[model samples]
Target: MSSFRVKGGLKLKGEITPQGAKNEALQILCAVLLTEEKVTINKIPNIRDVNKLIELLADMGVKVEKVGPESYTFQADEVDLNYLDTQDFLKKASALRGSVMILGPLLARFGTGRLSKPGGDKIGRRRLDTHFVGFQKLGAKFEYDSKQEIYKIDGTNLKGTYMLLDEASVTGTANILMAAVMAEGQTTIYNAACEPYLQQLCDMLNRMGAKITGVGSNLLNIEGVEKLNGTEHTLLPDMIEIGSFIGLAAMTKSEITIKNVQVEKLGIIPETFRRMGIKLEIKGDDIYIPSQEHYEIETFIDGSILTIADAIWPGFTPDLLSIVLVTATQAKGTVLVHQKMFESRLFFVDKLIDMGAQIILCDPHRATVIGLDRKYPLRGIRMTSPDIRAGVSLLIAALSAEGTSVIDNIEQIDRGYQYIDQRLNALGADIVRID
Candidate 1:
């Protein structure tokens, strides 16, 4: 297992550019299977999960070419449908949660899609019901083999209709939308996830001949087209990474500028950090967070304790709650972080507590952080990364602590973050990867 030996108590300075959105890249990469024409994608993050998805595509006979350091051109002219039934396919696809996305495109185009139980962060139970149910609603025959833990979907004669999702799941919406793009008729999806990345998918599909309306709203109307063509698409900067950088700057008392952040799509992330008393400035498209000796948390208008909770898009993202929880450690006041979406995310607070932060693990879903006001800096210790967001949060804590901290299982961090140590080292952080 790879681990990170992070030397703490160093301030990082310099401009860092956030990588391409990991979440969006997964959806966009899967969409490449919809057409046989050449589709070029830029700003692809060189991360483990995204790289694994690309490898899966290549193994499935999609022709992939590297055009630049962060650009790739893909053509699915001769996809091997037989590969989907192979044990190698199950082994590769089951390891990636993004693999489930390929089902929609494959089902829509080739009439059959099969997947083993997909794997990802073990944060909590992320059900595949939404994806399968939405497919079933689109006239696809769904069957599950309990013994093999495989899902089979057949869309021989898909004809779209209306669907009101039980939840606005981002991946679920992307999967269903991809299938609906080439269905026989109109498909209306209410309560759809309207995240910026999903909107980008809709825009990309529209550019490729799919008629999709309500680009930024929950109600998406898709008029199915007979075919889709290839188009060039550029992914947005990862907002989660941007938020993590903001937290890192505040926690380590660093003067850092995050460049080309696509500020308009960040959606209340900056303001949410400001509510934690962290001072940041917006310059054109970059975010400048100045160093601070101490910051404080804000209270509600009625003078109640501030609660930082995650909601659907337009609300604060759940991905950053771990960052927010860690950033609140050195602030002046206390804040309750409600991780509504995932139960196990707040479990990392025990590690922060070990680092001299005062945090109360109220339950599996919530944590109360009492800021130390920087009076006593966190002292580093040995810990293990549990999930992607929690792993990055622990890294931020280790960076601000006194002395060196050894973090095991940093592969979790690498899955989402691209060259995190190298990038931070450029900004003056002292981190060594012990492979």
Candidate 2:
């Protein structure tokens, strides 16, 4: 097992470029399967989950060539359908939830897709009902082997039909949209996920001859095409990482610049930080966070304690809530952080409390953080990372603490973060990756 050994109480300086969007890359990478021609993708994050998906594609007969450190070219000229039916393929696909998306492309192009129960962060109930039900709307048959926990989807006669998603699930919408792109007739998706990830996927598909409109809205209309051609796409900077850097700089009182962040696409992320009274300057695609002795949490307009909550796209992303919650521990005022989307996310705050932060876990989805006002710096303690976001939050807390800290189960962090230890080391962080 890999662990992160962090020495706390050090100010991190310098700038680091944000990695490519992990969520977006997952959907976009699966999109390569929609065409047989060569697709060149740049800005692909070299993380465990994404790399695993690329390896899975290679196993399924896609020609994957590493053209650059963060770039790849994929050609699905000869997909091995029989390979998908193997136990080996099932074992590989079960390692990450992104693998569930292959079902859409596989069924769309080859009329059948089989997969094992995909694994990912155990944050909450991340159901795939929306994805399977959407496929059923497009003339697909969905079956499950309860014994093996496997899914078999067949879309031999997929025809376009309208679908209003139960929720604006990011992965579910992307999967169904990919399947609909080449199906017969038209497909109208109401309440579609309008996150940048889905928008990028639609843009790439449209460039490949698929007629899709409503790029940045909850409503999407996709016209089926005979096939999608090869296309090139580049990923935007990861907003979650940018937010994490902002929180890191605040908690550690360090001057840090996050390079090349697309400020436009980071809808409510910056403002959310501002609401916490954190000082930040947005300079033409970069975020400059000045070191501060103390950052205060703001009150509501009617003079109530501030509350930060998560919602769908155009709202505060759920991914950054963990970072914000940890940063709030050292701020000057108390604030209530309500993680409405997931139940178990707020549970990690107990770990922060163990590190000398004053936080009240009101429920599974909400917490009231009473800031320490920088009076008592947290002392490092041994801890285990629960999930991807929480893992990073603990690391930030450990860095802000006053002693040495060891965080176990760091592979959870590796699944999303690419070369995090090496990247932070360049910024003067004393983080040693140990096995």
Per-residue CA lDDT of candidate 2, range 1-435, in tens?
Answer: 999999999998999999999999999999999999999999999999999999999999999999998899999999999998899999999988999999899888889999999999999888899999999999999899999999998899899999899999999999999999989999999999999878889989999999999999999998999888999999999999999999999999999999999899899999999988899999998999999999999999998999999999998999999999999999999899999888998888878988999999999999999998899999999999999999999999999999999999999999889999999888888999989
Model 1 Cα shift for residue 344 (angstroms) = 0.9
**So what's the TM-score on candidate 1?**
0.99
For candidate 2, the lDDT comes to 0.93
Poorest lDDT segment (10 consecutive residues) of candidate 1: 341-350
List all candidate RMSDs to the true structure: 0.6, 0.8
Q: Give the TM-score of candidate 2.
A: 0.99
362-407 in candidate 1: lDDT tens per residue? 9999999999999989999999999999999999999999999999
Q: After superposition, which runs of candidate 1 have C-alpha atoms over 4 Å from their true positions?
A: none
Prediction-by-prediction clash tally: 0, 0
lDDT of each: 0.96, 0.93
